[model samples]
Target: MPTPNPAALEFLLTRRSRPWRTLCLPAPDRDALHPLLTAAARTPDHGKLEPWRFIVLERPALDAMAQMVADRGGVTGVEPEKLSKSQAEYATSPLAVVVVAAPKPSEKIPQMEQHYSAGAVCLALLNAALAAGWGANWLSGWPSRDPEITAWLGLSETESIAGIIHIGTESAIPPDRPRPDLGKLTTWFTP
Candidate 1:
């Protein structure tokens, strides 16, 4: 029989992302965040090729980034609503972690696998934050994908943002959203 961790399983089953807009102040400090990052770093890494990194964005940086997005919005022709949403995400966020998918060169491992590892890191970080009683949400928008913004983030030519995870205190508990239908989404295969 397989030994199971009931608490962990329960947490996984019930985990829900707190909306970014609903997140407030009292964000985790560097010391507090150290463990969360450590937990994230423990994500499965094939071949020990660590293909990701974290970039913590505190309030000041987020505010500046928000302004940068606004400044570039008009010139870049970003739609008004989209621009506003993106700006608000940064401006109001207490803290954020940018999971940069920096894939290291590997002879056996494929580049796509490295990208997947980065994505896994993002989820692990998000979950770690939530498990630590902090409200967390994984987000990405036009700003994340914009070359200029990515450049501002100091990403290299090959690096990309797997996710931008917002972490802070929750103003209010968000209602649980509908989950996907497991029967429809899953497939049972047999030879």
Candidate 2:
């Protein structure tokens, strides 16, 4: 018989992402963050191709990236409000993990699967941080989709930002948002 972990189930049921704006200082240090990263790395990879990597961005790096976002936004003629939001996301975060989707060459595995795996890694990392008693939120803005930002972050041509997971202490707990109705979303098939 498989061992049932009620606590784990309870956690999953109640897990809620803290708002990025609500995240404050006292973020996890390198030593504290290492295990969370390790846990994230354990996410499923269909072809055993680790199609993702994490870039731990500290305060200074975040500030630099925020500037880059603003500069890139200017060059791209992005709307001022959008640009400001993007800049704030980077500048205000105490710590962030950029989950890059670096798909590997594979004849058998589809590129879509690799992309899905990368997304999984992002969620895994977010969950890991949350489980470790840190507030975390996965964010991807215009910068995440822009080639200039990718180049600034030192990603190869094929690698893209799957997510930018902001991690820190929660200054305020956000009220729970409405969840999907599983009954409505689910479909049971019988033959």
Q: Using Cα atoms with residue i matched to residue i, what is each candidate's TM-score against the true structure?
A: 0.98, 0.97
Clashes of each: 0, 0
Give the per-residue lDDT digits (tens) of candidate 1, residues 1-191: 99999999999999999999999999999999999999999988998999999899999999999998998887899999999998999999999999999999989989999999999999999999999999999998888888988999899999999999999999999899889999998989998
Error of 1 at 86 (Å): 0.5
Look at candidate 1 and tell me the lDDT of residue 48.
Answer: 93
Scored by CA lDDT, what does every candidate get? Answer: 0.94, 0.93
Candidate 2 residue pairs that clash: none
Error of 2 at 140 (Å): 0.4
